[model samples]
Target chain A: MSTRHDIAAPPTEGGAAPGRPAPATGPTEADRRRRARLSRRWQRDLRWSPYAFVSPFFVLFLAFGLFPLIYTGWASLHQVELTAPTDMTWVGLRNYTRIFDDEFFWNAAKNTLMIGIISTVPQLLMAMGIAHILNYKLRASTFYRVVMLAPYATSIAAASLVFVLLFGRDYGMINWALDQVGIGKVDWQNDHWASKVAVSSIIIWRWTGYNALIYLAAMQAIPQDLYESAALDGASRWQQFLHVTLPSLRPTILFTAVVSTIGASQVFGEPLLFDANKGASGGAEHQFQTLGLYLYEQGWVNQHLGRASAIAWTMFLILIVIGIVNYVISRRLRASS
Target chain B: MTTTLTKPEDAAPPVRKSRKPRAARAGGHMHGGPIAYAILVLFSIGSLFPLVWTAIAASRDNNRLAQTPPPFWFGSNLFHNLDVAWTDANLGEAFVNTTFVAGVSALTIVFLSTIAGFAFAKLRFRGRGALMLLVIGTMMVPPQLSVIPLYMMVAKLDWTDQLQAVIFPSLVSAFGVFFMRQYLIQALPDELIEAARMDGASSWRVVWHIVFPAARPAMAVLGMLMFVQTWNDFLWPFLVLTQTGNPTVQVAVAGLGRGYTPDQSLIMAGALLGTLPLLLVFAIFGKQIVGGIMQGAVKG
Candidate 1:
């Protein structure tokens, strides 16, 4: 222990030497010349290496990312479809205008937002609570942590299909359980709100554990000393959790929230599978059609590529705004922390 | 002070006195505590119930599954459903095509991202920071925005319905590059590269010998993630691989539900088969996958 302590102490002293050079002992002429040469070489290498290391990303991005985004924006301005390619015409802002007037578009937007809020809030809260439990001294912590991530890893398409069976009205296990509890069977697919609820439940089920594990990791990083101090001061577990754990987890929470929002906004597979019986239009009335499904319907099903591209751009803009708002909030929270 | 108060239970337990107090406290906590556990267990069951149900339902005859208060237990029709799905959808072809597309796409993404990420993390050149910023910036833009243009491009190239359409467009993954860059930044120390250089190793040699070996774990994580993403992907595959014979797994499953009253057992069997590889991948690399996600979250 003494040897280890001795080894660590000299690093601080050595670091301080660079900060405060010994008087009249800074450098000899040879040392000065050698230092200057070394510094110039180091600067040159630093300048070259970073660019060399980072150029491939830029090259690929220019080709794939930037060009595609610009092209999408351009495509959105034109009136185009899959079949009538020869009838391409520029229709400025018409697609966007159509989206505002379209009831189906509005319904999709509403469903997307509704599902986003319904799934993300409960998912986050459950994650936080579960993480708190996991953070405590527990046996088989690693096993639980690994097990929790299973739903997230499961294929979305497969999970959605499974969920479709589970949410089936007559013979599904969910209804059977509900029947056992004296509740009547819900026509999960027939009702709009129930369908939305069922879809959101799938999202929450898959993601809650993943988010909880993340929160647990963040919780583990919080100093045990803080918890001890809180305990000594007569703070209950809940109180300490509220005051310390929540505040400490603010950034991670915000991150999950933003990601959840982005993910939710693009909710497609669940609703697609949920309404597959309705020709993948999300529902007969388009009740559960999210923005993502709307985009899919416009682009693929109706072959209205221009309008679909417009919706995609609109989604992108909304995501950017939400992301910026999230960034601002996260920064403020981090500053306070 | 805190240690002292909590230490009594650890040291010599004062038999009767300690037992009584501890048991009382434990009992009080337990009544309130099991609620959380109950809820969790319930949700866990709810979460896995569908998968379990699918397995059972897939094995049951149509008549059995269609019965009221559906049979929770398995029946002897697994092969029947499998045979139906296999012959009906020609899933054997779909599976091969899906595997080929996913495998090629994943390998391409790994190769491209690793090289690109190594360049981004280690090589110092002009516009390095700007390029990285640009790559990270693109991550926020949903892929939906570009699907139209991408569709147009594929159509113009006569690549629509071709495997290349699926494989090529997904080659440049921003998240993969970012992930690999982060991993490389930490794993590949400057000293190691400097040492390699000092020993007269060329730049390519330095990267291959010094950097690539250190990046295996990160590469594995990236590979697994890409594999799962590619395998499970529906939208792009559905759009691009529109040919009847070349349908991907998800596309094939979607097609299964499109015609006449869909065969529930057959569909479930197909879904289960489609998800099997993903489940296996997760089972094996669940820790690294979770770790990679958490690491990305922290860095972001």
Candidate 2:
């Protein structure tokens, strides 16, 4: 720590504070030559420092990020296990074929897509509404913004655990609230649709505020004059939102939508935690099993590393397809607009 | 736009006229009516309800929680649950592990990203733009998609069940690099770098002295983001650190809900313990975090 403090001390002591540049002094010929010589020597080393600075990330990425992605493709071809990876037998395209035939894989995929859509659509809409509301000059907006992000601060595991209690079948607050409202007690974890709703509720609860804040930021950046002009033209708040805010927020909306979709597709922790009683298969019947959980169940629990690789690659393709679709749609919107 | 507005007006003249004031030019101190407030309040409650419920449950023991209506208020068992969480639940070790991993990872991310950001933002070097773009591009590739391979890599390095399995993989975030680079581009000037260079300071010295201090607000935001993310991360840690000894707070909290004899109060207490520190941090640095996320989203 002291060594670090020592290394850091010189710049703080010697360099001017931000926004204040050092004053230029007239340099004598001798001084200029000395500086040039020093610079020439330093320049040789300086050329590589940026590379040195940036290499750590790329190195980590290559090892952990890119290599894994590419290796998943290679590994999926072979029949491998977590423990005995070297004794693998290559069976090209067999794992993919096998996963395709596996009903559990399809079940998991459907669950993932269902939950992703169930969570994402309402989350984004609520986010937009909240952003619109918060964009207005409201008292204690900062406090609301902070409160909105409270769920974001909570770890997914912790949040899911809390939700488990809330969504409890017999003693849950949700059922209690429903009972108070004269509705029947819905078995949240047992029923198919109810479980999806319960799971999506967790996702929605966590992300809506975060997405709203993003939209609010974009909304804030929209020229205030646009709204004023719209108002001067006798447009109502609804009309202004439709004609002004919504149109202006297209890029940000698309961006957030794409990001949210990508994130939702990889829903792991919530379902994993939500399936507390049902083990890691998502449920006894694999009701809420997402692809992420399936991958874990396969690779870690079943020890079928090859099959997990196939699932990983499948997820990658789905994301890429969605990404390309989003890109095309966004580009078209930009072009038409 | 005018034609569209007129069309809407024609379609629903009375409804449009009635809603006019609500939409009355933007930038007012208030938006929406009592209905909007009601909706926001309801949604806010919905958002906070789970945590509130958990807190209530945490205060109650198993029997009280199993009551027909369930306990809705603080019970005497709060301390007992916390004790169980601390001693019996393995959360004490989990807390220690989480702090160590998150702290180390956040510090490393900030340090590496800031320098890389500095290099990308101000340093004139060959392939700088391309390299920076490559770094930015990695953000598009969701890391979870590569989990299988990453698992193998960790295992190959014999790092499984270790905290470094979590820390090393996350030490340098592409998002942090991009975020820092963007901030530096706007906050820093080439004149500052040249000025320091002219002062007979080494390049490293110039960066440490001039660029880093100036980049603190950005770095702090980035570091806080990383810390919170690492604290909250589950899947990677859950996968790598399967051992009871190495479990992160999040993994430990997850484990609370997974057992055959799952204790509601203990789980709730454990969740609270895992969540509260970051929530407190959120309360303190909420504005900066909000700003950082907003800026990141907007810039993207």
Candidate 3:
């Protein structure tokens, strides 16, 4: 990282004064000669200074951001025992093969998808609804917007803890509210379905407002004439909404969908903190163990770096596919509309 | 729906009959009467309930919290809970560590990304377009997927258990650079750079004098986003800082809740303590935060 300082290296003699152009004439007086030299230096510096200016991001990215990902791919091909450095064995595709056969990996992947779908679908729909409401001439709109985003500002650790307590079996508020409506006791932690719902609820609670605000911004950008034209065509309120607003918000909807998908697949802290007794296992039976936590459990907890690297590569591949699909869909939507 | 306003231009008026011309009244009840307010207020209460409950729980003892239909009012145990969280849960050390890490990291992100953003937006250079595209492309690849190799890199550097392990990797965010670049492209004019050059100002001088000051607002938004993100960051820190007394606030809060024999009151207090700084930030910069999100969403 100390190499980052080189980005601000002192300008060379020919690069001493940047951003100034060189003189056109060859022969000159001493003062002119000196000024021309200085001007030439500035021109040279200007030619290359953008590289210097942008080096920090690349330098840091190379060291910390990109290298780790590449190293993970390399390590995934080898059986590197973390505790015994000298015992590394070249095992091509074995780790990936083993992961394919591992139930925990599949389980974690399943839970990740389940929670991702359950949490993201409802959350996005609700956000669109809320954004729709806020897009109107509401009273105290700023106050509502501010309050809506308050949950987003809270730390996941804190928010999940609050939810964990709220999801408690005997003394939890959720169950208490349920009981008043004649529902039975819910073992939120132990029951597999209930635990997933609890984890998803925390995510939905934390992010719905954030997505809503984004939707609202997109909604506001829709030209007023579009809505008016639809209204004048004898379209009902619902027809105008379906034709004018939803269609206009297609790109934004796709953007949020992809962003939320990436976020949902990486869900971790909530489940880890939600089940106090289970630690990173997610639950007593690993009921809600997401792929993110699975990667952690394999690498750090179990000291299986090779398998963890495999998992990391798998996640990377999954994200790449999803990202490309999202890009294509968004482009198609833009082209169509 | 029943309004007979047929003209396309006049259609905007009858839809929003009372106020705010051409607001998206595609849905019925666009005027948002008391019922809309009621629904919005209900959702707001639901959104705030957890934080409110956390505050209420933080003031109460574990005995009261353990009761069925747990105590909903404030108790006299606030001091005790704070003390327990500070000393027993090691939240004080975590607080200091998180503040140092988040503060320094946010500052670095703002400074570095501002320069890089200016360069990307205004500078003409070889491979500038390719590099910009590369930076944006990396945004799709999340750090979580590379956590394993990142851990190895830290281990090779022997930086595990050190704050640098957490802070260094986060100093330059692609999203921050992208955001700042997008903002600078719109906010800055090439004429300004050209004028500075005509006056024989060095590139560095031009950036510092003309660009930095002009980009301060965008820099502030990037700084706030970075600070909040770093402060809330969990998984990376949780992996690196295995030592007990050296945890960040979020990790310590996780530990408080992760244990089997956890004290509910202490966990509540820790959660509140961890969240207080960011909540204060939100209170002051709520509008900017919303704006930042919209900007990212629109461009993204």
Candidate 4:
């Protein structure tokens, strides 16, 4: 196997001394034979060391990563409870079929989709605009970047705690400001759409700056000549951004979209903490309950292990389908380009 | 997602027409305008105001916080509230527990990822491509899919409420391995490894003397990122660790706001205490963290 690289060729026995002088009587047959055996041992080390190096990660991944995934799928086909996770009865596809009739599941699914769009779309567009502005030679840009990233540094628990207080209907800062400006108070937690927007805003607030930095990285990496060429053609700044910058950033845009979608689907902590009094029920009427929260409610809160397993598999299946569609679209884009 | 080259490439640019007269027209006035600065200023406030207000709210009494037109300025009761949150919320223990868990996890992840990354980056091993693809695939397997079995194993091993329950599952990261592999492939030259080999350096010696030194910067950065991630991880920790007994920061903080009549200021204080350490981390090593994310984003 080490034959792939010419430079890794095994050394010949006794590989001539670099700066030391050899004895006039040279090497005895036994000395040369011993050196040849040492060379083979060294060659063996070279050949096998890479496997030794990489085994730890694969081993850990197998145990904690791969096995659990398959086990969850297997457990989904049975009826089990949190009281005794080991006690299982065969109920093939019942959990999956029950999901079809589960209204809470559908509500969570709808909320997940709406929240995903609300959170991801504006976050990315704002990120794109910010990244464009940041491409300008600015003063104290790192300071801006760091300050923008401060929200990201805040944990979900902490951020949600702060936001819940800020968005309180009666005594919150936003309502106070709105009242001062002659606007009526809005019940953020009780109102269905308002609650979802409030939840989505937390995600957007945390991630927009991060995605902006990513886009900024991509923008900085754009070859300057592309801009110059566009300018030579007398394109306006906005036009250059549309024609040149946007096209160059296609892959980065797709990348962020995929990441945000995955993140959006797994929206748990924000909604969970946003309604701290109600715990896993997202809201009083389950208005903003995402799939992730629903999974938690079924498994941990309600102790329906089999149902939770099914939800897990269902989420995985949805992600896989989306991934396949993404792959096809990207492939077509690549082909056409 | 792995197939996407969404990460910005940091490759060296080809030759440019540096002296061309037309270059000035393209980007000579690249500085932001007044309107741009205004927008940036507004965004910065939106980004930072909640954190600033958390401090204000933390310093006030519970009654003050529950009143309309919340205190915009600091209150004298900050230290008093912090003291209460510290003792009542068991944040002191949580801080230590979280530090140990995050530190051990980050170090293990960095060390293992570097060695494995070196293998994937340079070594000519059997099934290298397939194995690397497997590593990439592992990144997309959501934690929700895998937690039930991990929970079962933890319960079986009597690891519930133990730091090991949290630490064990986070010991290695696929992203760490991928990021390191990307770095070493470009940073560590093959010629150098070949020279070391020619000098009869054993595989271990080559890793120690050559690979690690080349990987020091990336290793440090990756350690910080992993630390932040593990520090902020909530769901799994919430499931396993009980707040009263062995809470991490998030669990402890989450516990603060519960019950029929909660102390509002005390909750804010706990939230502030839990968030301050990492914000300190961001304040200090932020630029490097920014660099790390962007660098890892491209190939990672």
Name the top TM-score candidate. Answer: 4
lDDT of 4 by residue, A95-148 (tens): 999987999999999999999999999999999998888777778877888888
Per-prediction DockQ comes to 0.24, 0.34, 0.35, 0.41
DockQ of 1: 0.24
**Which candidate leads in DockQ?**
4
Query: Could you say which candidate leads in lDDT?
Result: 4
Order by TM-score, highest first: 4, 3, 2, 1
Model 1 scores a C-alpha lDDT of: 0.73
Across A137-250, the per-residue lDDT of candidate 1 in tens digits comes to 444445566667767766667777778877889878789889989997998887988988999988998899889877866775566667778888999978988988888787
Which ten-residue region of model 3 chain A has the weakest summed lDDT? A1-10
List model 3 lDDT by residue over B15-129, tens digit each: 2242233333433236776877887898799788898889899999887877777777788888788777877668888889999999999999898888888899988898989
Please give, for residues A300-336, the per-residue lDDT of candidate 2 as tens digits.
8899999999999989888889878987998899898
TM-scores, all candidates, are: 0.84, 0.89, 0.90, 0.92
- CA error at residue A256 for candidate 4, angstroms: 0.9
Q: Which runs in model 3 stand beyond 4 Å of their true positions?
A: A1-28, A84-87, B1-30
Ordered by lDDT, highest first, the candidates read: 4, 3, 2, 1
Q: i-RMS values of the candidates, in order?
A: 8.1, 5.5, 5.9, 4.3
Candidate 2 residue A174 C-alpha distance from true site, Å: 1.0
Error of 4 at B25 (Å): 14
Considering just the first chain, candidate 4 attains a TM-score of 0.92
Which regions in candidate 1 have their CA more than 4 angstroms from the true location? A1-53, A84-87, B1-40
**Backbone clashes, each candidate:** 15, 3, 2, 1
Q: Where is model 4 more than 4 Å wrong at Cα?
A: A1-9, A12-26, B1-29
Summing lDDT over every window of 10 consecutive residues in candidate 4 chain B, give the lowest-scoring window: B6-15
